[model samples]
Target: MEATYCAGVLSRGKLPVSNLRKSDHGFQRLTSQRKAIASVSCHLSNGLGESSCKSHGFHGGSYHGGAVGKGKDPILQTRCSAGVSMYGESFLESHSHATEDKIGVLLLNLGGPETLHDVQPFLFNLFADPDIIRLPRLFRFLQWPLAKLISVLRAPKSKEGYAAIGGGSPLRKITDEQAHALKMALEAKNMPVNIYVGMRYWYPFTEEAVQQIKRDKITRLVVLPLYPQFSISTTGSSIRVLQNIFREDACLSRLPVAIIQSWYQREGYVRSMADLIAKELERFPKPEEVMVFFSAHGVPVSYVEDAGDPYKDQMEECIYLIMQELKARGINNDHTLAYQSRVGPVQWLKPYTDEVLVELGQRGVKSLLAVPVSFVSEHIETLEEIDIEYKELALESGIKNWGRVPALNCTSSFITDLADAVIEALPSAKAMTNSEGTSEEMDNDPLRYLVKMFFGSVLAFILLLSPKMVLAFRNHLF
Candidate 1:
């Protein structure tokens, strides 16, 4: 019955689909969007388009499932069974509750230019985000023109970077693999899940993913970004996009959603980093002598100081947790954390990765193992900057041995943990607070500290003055 309802919902509309085909310059943007209707037809018809038919299992001439509104045609109802089909497959099923609840996991990431041509547009998208480039209300109108001009100016260097890294970024490929691995891992645990990769600033944009999710008629959604640590310009931007899109879509607005803001300190995640570091350490003659250099992507310092961004604080804690895990395994090596990918002559998080590498070389540190601690997969930063640019610099600075820890793309333990994190994040109710899952150590901002103290004092006063109002106030805590 659930499978039948899902088929009906998918078949009712011709889904405006975007192809995931590889292009030399990036995704091909066709004028007329292709429909995935044929795929749905194939699923329901079992290789026969409207000819091969079964009982369909629908009753009362209606789908009568969650996808359909009350008093609407039951035929329009949507239901997918768990473990019944993979995402993008014909059957949409959930493993939870007799497959009544369909789960959609949207994997978010900062997409890179697929080719040289895509560099400018990608940059435009990046800079256009209000979180990335803050503007006063009076100057808001200049955002587009400024973004355009900046993209045009930055395109050459950006193109060069992409060209050096095989003329594009493999972020899409890596993200796709991550999605598949996560889906399979969840399925193994009897959790029906379909993974969708939604890149900010590229093909399969958040908007595209939102349309796809609506068409899929997902009952529940998990917005799990690829960035392990949350940042305003990355995860927060994506979340805002989702929130705005869902607000406009009636169907999506009613859907239950659980968002995992960050999972940098997950035990499995930290262990995965530790394992990679250990493996890389084996390449050196004396592993203990090698520095475990953690290179994380940087953000403008203003983001932290003015905008109340907790990115750096979270990153520092993430590094600390990974070191703790490494220590538990009895592997101790000198370690340091530095920020990379600073742009546009603004102050960013420090110490800078490049500066640190040069200093280490000058200090006669011949052996070092570089770690892309914040990056889950290899991209321009890791492949071109770290491997090519940084490596060349290290060699010129007299560093004899230099190696980088491999990214945790589709690592079994890491994927398993990703699945677990999503499952744990899904709430029995409509929403769950991120503070419940995120480590308290990440909340180090003075503003939050002040807020907590103020609230504590207020609560005490209320308790002393009016004990009866306590229950009323308790309802507003969340």
Candidate 2:
């Protein structure tokens, strides 16, 4: 039933713009229902707003779906009569109240080319980002020309890649499915939400999303990047661009925005990943014998070394946590993490996925399950780079069997998890980070390292003393 609901949403991905506009009424209905339950206003990172969101309901405010709650916000306390049966009895019944505060969720991702002609320009937009190609401030002026040159040189090969993957990338389709699923999930939970998709460098770009958000008159905004693990080049670049645009406009500059930078550690996200792996493992005759290979998208090494980007660190930790979750599920298969999609003459995060595959093949690890860890939706990276190119490489490298985990696009559990993250972020969303290192404070803190080391030693000692007790210790630590 959940799969059916997800399928319904996926089908909507191809809907024309006119049809999508028609769906606004459904979102407004959701907003009106949610406004009845909660009246609390936006909670600012700097400080709480002087006037509550509830105050606008009675003030003849021009906001869409008017203020939701009058005195107090009731998130899930009141049950409405509207809910899908697939969500079970726990979902709140939908109700209506006057509201002007419409919750707008902006989904951010690196948009892909829809045709071969778009490949070069997409590549240019990607390489043009200073985050992708680091340049000293004095030399930054060269980025545009350099990006142009690289895109021209790389376009033919990239065009072939898209050609193999049905002549385009399915990223936008998958992302739209995710957006629709999230909207349903939020509405089921009795929250007013309208989801907007914003691709960084292609059609429906960030600027376009902002324009739509403004046109719709969204009262409060929640920015959720599709990247689970935060990276300076990906999430950081998107958020920074968005905040800069918001600052330029008087209305948007004053609009309250909540930011969910990353959710790599979220339990539901980990579980959804584990579930995908488990399903993939079932395809193998000997599931336990197959090795788990996590292939994350790579970034220039200098981004981490010189710019203090914590992406590499976050990727490592994310892999560890996912493995831990798999272990908890009693799947103790050997696993390896490698980076993929490297570009240019410069070194990227290593060991490269292709290199790792070659080494594994030489070592006679015959069966393998490749997981695309950095991406949540199907794109050229997964369709061409992993499934096509790497699969052929793996099979030719003497691997008897090979498989790749499907991207988690609109999976019910993952969508529910996203809805929770959005709801949690709305109340205390901070402005996007200004500097690259700002997001890495907790990761770089000396005390954090000391505590981790202390706990690591303790766990090791406990394992040596009593293997059984390690289970208890693990439970406590988690």
Candidate 3:
């Protein structure tokens, strides 16, 4: 549980020799403390021709080794020495550089089909991920084959969906604008930072961002998954992919990275969303007599029950929190949560957004406000799916007014809220100890240790029971 330390600088595209320090002698003697610990220094080369070397001591004796690169030169070089201390008063100092002390913000997002031609391939990429499908290893092979077959059958119909709005998904364009707006907002605050977009399912993937980070020689990274509400199927999957890639690539693994797992409960976020809703309500003839419908992208029900993904719960919490904010602002009327854009015949979380609109229309709800709560930027889901498709549905159902709250793309308030969320989520930026003893010390704290143990046990039990649960549920439902 002790904090690990590594000190080295890049040299000739490889990690150069560095020194390690032991400072445990200053600590009070304890039975748990062990002496004569060994440490090893290793160099990691990200496949993208970048090398980073790190050195840390373990209980066993330390050793040194070099890694061979596939191309022009050796990728990483490392040397190990015992009883050498490179302790710094501040842990952040170890990673900080004089030239660039700015925080690096990476926006993690899901990229959709860019053009009409890209729609089928984009969906195929999304369905191909094992994390998303959650099928058995053998069945996974069957799943992708089946997915491709279904894609062929669904492409024509899906293409029509794309054509309804335009010939492409608006995700990439909206995301780019969001990134630029965020950058300007941070600059206005004089917060030294660079914002980069890393997509999960399409162009500008996470791997590409990792490579770019290496190329930029960024010292600290703050990864912000764009989902306001987190779920294992989305944010969790992205984090796992990043973790695995970091584990395999040495250069990326060595960099200091912190993830903002979820910010659904952030005050600024909830307030900004409430503000959007409040402004939209003004356009309606009867602001007080409107039904507010929160439409979130739907995932399979099995993912919620079997995988223990907190998406639905988190989404519901978000709606509740936003409603509370609206009430506090004296703008409350009536609101409902519904799931949207469900694919496949399998039942998704309901009431379906479109279906809800129809039923509301039938019930004489003349004016309705549709809010896409899951997504931050306007994409096909908002512009095409909700605006075009759902608009027609509402008209067909004899509802006179159907308006969607604009997506939070590049809005000043939204960008400011995003920056506030990031700053609030991060630990204090002030300098602190870089001693390995601190990690050990914190681990020994009863409260911290208990929480870790509790979560670990719960996760283990869930995994053990997941397969049977998934099978049973699928058998009964499908």
Candidate 4:
């Protein structure tokens, strides 16, 4: 599933653009070479967003990826850069009687196709997202067209993987259960807030959830991305969508909102993860000797080194914390971390999961346990990729026994912790209005953006037109 998801739906290559203003360029479709160019461009990294996404709020820099500036106003990356700022120095006192208000907890996640038929459109949505694929400004107008082309081509393989994993993605069903569980958990705490699931790519899209928030007259809102760790590609993407929507709607614009940027550092989450890993380790003959392999989803290295994405940093720290919990419980074991589900034409976070499994097997590791640290629910990447593909590779390479730690779908402790996070963020519930000085980082320098777009267009033109590149593209998809 990891290989297919990336090679099919998320398969993208970066290219440059040309003569790029904010206008549509043309009606040029070369069918004779369409397959070649599309397939090749689908996986190669044109590195277009490298400049636009620079700093991503790192170092001594106050701004982070799509987020409000750090320090006193540290908040989610919101591009809601319009209207008057209604918030004050501290949002905790900005609104009184929040307890009496109708509170809504929005859980943002990555959506998946529910059935084989939904694959194409889901792929289209995934690729159409500039946050996901990062197209050049010159080719910005081609976003939809490019999305359609790639989705149609990749649908066959994507559907096959979905079919293998029971003909669809269980992400929706699991996410819904999580929402139900979170609601119940919050209610148990005597702080009941309506829980809504907003998937980034598929059904129950964030836009749909926003509309419901309007209809339900929800007063206080808390955005809790299902992602335990923050990443511009995940939490930032969803928040940006909310930022865009909230910026336009008057009622939403003024709504009191608090966003839990990340919760991996939370104690409950760390304990829950340790618990899962410990239990899974017991399945092996010598639990103490079992190799604890953590396979996390991968992102382009540029997202970290260049864009200042904290995903790798947070992931490492999360692992450390979880390991500390395990050690405290007297369950210390050999462990390693690797990245999976890489896409595009660039380098992703290394050591690739596949290569690591082979290396471990060659090292004569007999018993191994795979822990999916980044994901909280069982999805294709877990059910198919790690469980099936990696497991098979492990046995063939040399290892004999293998087991995977289950996702914290509705684990009691995890849910309860999530509830606590929402309650804790209420005091800081901020309205994403312009006066907060949060949206400036999102725009960057307009001149720099334009120049990047121009160069991007030129590079894209050259890449798609090259003969060798065309052949490589054809071999990738066709």
Candidate 5:
């Protein structure tokens, strides 16, 4: 029996798909207009998609699964077993000319400036995101104004960094390469699908990608954030955007969408990071003695403490996985993880990368290797911050020799693993439903909107002015 769930029943954000790199340049990329299909439920043929999601025996780092809904969507559904790799030989065999199965893989990433002039606007877009500044919801209207102020303040130094790295951040260029490579890898496995790059803050924004997906009439979409680990400020922000869009758009809401939350724990990714470290280690005079320094982009401690972001845990586990691979290969020197690119006065995750570098130097550790574990592509963080700034800090701190591991950027092994991740996530794709009505349908209800907003504003004002009243009212109710 095909069970039909109500639209938006797959609640608490599971129905959505989802980073900013969470770098100095990270003021955080991507305001995350990246949210997809709010309140969407699964509609797998024969309930295979739901069952396989659990039967796969993976938790935490797997594709999001949702409750199934009736077909307001027109795409023909099929049984998608976890064990089934139908996207391969059988995919090509059965659907030799299957143009109907339009699968769009939207790769979400932090966008950086293309030139010196773009730096301020890019920063403005980033800081304009509430995730970057993190004010209470009631204060949100001030976001753009404050963002402009901060972006102006931040631009000069940021511009200097960009200038140091040849007048722009190569994030867009490198991300494009990764997208192309991922497409090729998928094509090789006979899973060719259109891949689209959605940068959060730059040109070809997530909104643009969504528009193109609509124009192309994409049947299935895989929202894949390039960030390997999940953070509230990065991946969560993007997911939120997608959810809003899904809620508003009739066509997108009904479209089948699958999201890969994070893939740092994937075997191939760990091995590939190890491969880079191992290859880089050979450069030092004594590979066995060189201390491996894992410098990941930092998020606020409050994100973990208050918001319960899994970033620190996931990052630690990712490093552990890679180090375990290295240990298995008998390359166990010594390693430590530190958080870097912290902005603002508030405390970020520590030990801070710069402070740790100085501490390592004072402790007499020489020939250290800096692995940019958080970022996958060469951007401002990897190129200028780690390569230039941190290197200078290390040399000044008395570290005799310093080496930095490069970003994964279209590496054969890394690209292959990403393709594998996409293939694994395909079985769990859940289509958005039109049963909830379209954005246009909702817009038709203007009086309802005004009443809601008017009351909301009144409530916010009350909360803003009368805390004591709220407390007294609550006590009286009790």
Candidate 6:
């Protein structure tokens, strides 16, 4: 007998119906709203839509196993064999049609000194990164140990920096808030996307977040380093660390990612900064006459000279952009850009922020507005270094008005612009599929790599030699 398949339907206390064809059958297509209905139909061979005949393993009416009603054929089987290949093709077609596109956004940041107790340790972590320290392998190890020792020794002094700023770093709290605000702002635009925050030298590190993206099955990632101004020292370091992590992790070997690198020149960012400065100037007794002082985070001059880090240059560019924005808004005023937070008696980019403040006061500039161009959020540098320390110096030097332009943390327009940047940076789905990526760059020190490789080879050679030397000694003894 020829094996046959049939579609049959049996309702409670009703006679069964079987073997219906496309021309004679009355079956409807499934609608999203009608998912509760228990029904099955088949698109069979010979280009026909057959409602009663089950060409695949599907039968109408409740689809439960065993008999239907008073069971003539106790085992109701549907003979729907639409070949495995065809089914797969159809599944792929449907899946491709159903899938929605998404953009992945990675938020790059400097990990902060967490807790009152963690301040010194956090600074040690920051100073230890090779990108920040630029020491040789042996010297790097020596430097780290010395840095640790120095950190312990200097803890009291650094604590003074923290103590003046309220005894702890507010960076973590502010960054967390910024992340949430950015997320909400993006979602409001109906451009729902994932926003990940990765810090350079702390928890939720770049490596950890990269692993998380792997776990989350995120195929496309766009890195947005939080620094408004791009510096080889700040944004470059973070990007380099991320690149290194990607190179080492096998799971991330094939993932697709892109980098925004910098948005310092973006109009929205410049305008937002300009607006902050303008608002601060409004508090002054004279807005246009007020001296505007812009201070950015300072890096060692050696790093700038050797690596040609564009930190100072980019900061100048950012300041110029903001000033231009201010000028366009009809608020032209004399402004100064100075570097802040130089440690360890080294020559940093000068004239220094503190010195400038004192000079402005001494020159008899009555009102001053200090703008922290480098920081997007209020942290130790802005809160403690400038707000407290420099403000006091200015006040003592006889400047009656001294106030700071607040860091752009969770401001509506600033957050919206950030969200816009994320949207702009998202890779096309096709591009995401073809690209292989991450952010860690190789160490610029060739000697470090050579030493590591040499030591590893030497250790292996010694291990191999040990067993043979022991065997030779044993044979001689025998």
Using TM-score, give the best candidate's number. Answer: 4
Model 3: how far residue 105 lies from native, Å: 1.3
Q: Considering TM-score, which of the candidate structures 4 and 6 is the better prediction for this target?
A: 4
Error of 5 at 236 (Å): 1.5
Each candidate: RMSD to true structure? 19.9, 17.8, 17.3, 15.2, 14.3, 26.2
Clash totals in order: 10, 13, 7, 24, 13, 8
Local error of candidate 6 at residue 431 (angstroms): 9.3
Instruction: State the lDDT of candidate 1 residue by residue for 232-293, as single tens digits.
Output: 66776666566545544777767877677677756678778889899889889998888788
Residue range 1-478, candidate 3, lDDT tens digits:
0000010111111111112212212112111122222221211111111122222111111111111122322122121111111222342343344225546677877776667787666666565555555553223224455446545656677677777767777776677677777766766655566677766666656655665565566666667788876666566656655654555576766666656656665566777899899999999998998888787887777666665555666666566667767877887688777777666445566667777778888888888888988888887778777888888998899888877898777777778877754443333222111222111122447886577667766654584368875565345322
Worst 10 residues of 2 by lDDT: 1-10
Predicted candidate 6 versus true structure: per-residue lDDT over 344-364, tens digit per residue: 444466667777777777888
Q: Ranking by lDDT, best first?
A: 4, 5, 2, 1, 3, 6
The predicted structure with the larger TM-score, 3 or 5, is 5
The residue pairs found clashing in candidate 3 are: 2-440, 20-84, 21-84, 21-85, 38-60, 39-57, 39-62
Tell me the tens digit of each residue's lDDT in model 5 across 221-262: 778889888765566555655655565588887886777767
Please name the candidate that would achieve the greatest lDDT relative to the true structure.
Answer: 4
Model 2 spans > 4 angstroms off: 1-100, 430-478
- Residue-level lDDT tens digits of model 2 in 78-192: 1111111111122222112212367788888877888888787777767666656665433443566666866787787788888998988888777777877888898787776
Instruction: Name the 10 consecutive residues with the lowest summed lDDT in model 6.
Output: 1-10
Q: How does residue 472 of candidate 6 score in lDDT?
A: 48
Error of 3 at 470 (Å): 22
Evaluate model 3: give its TM-score: 0.69
TM-score attained by model 1: 0.70
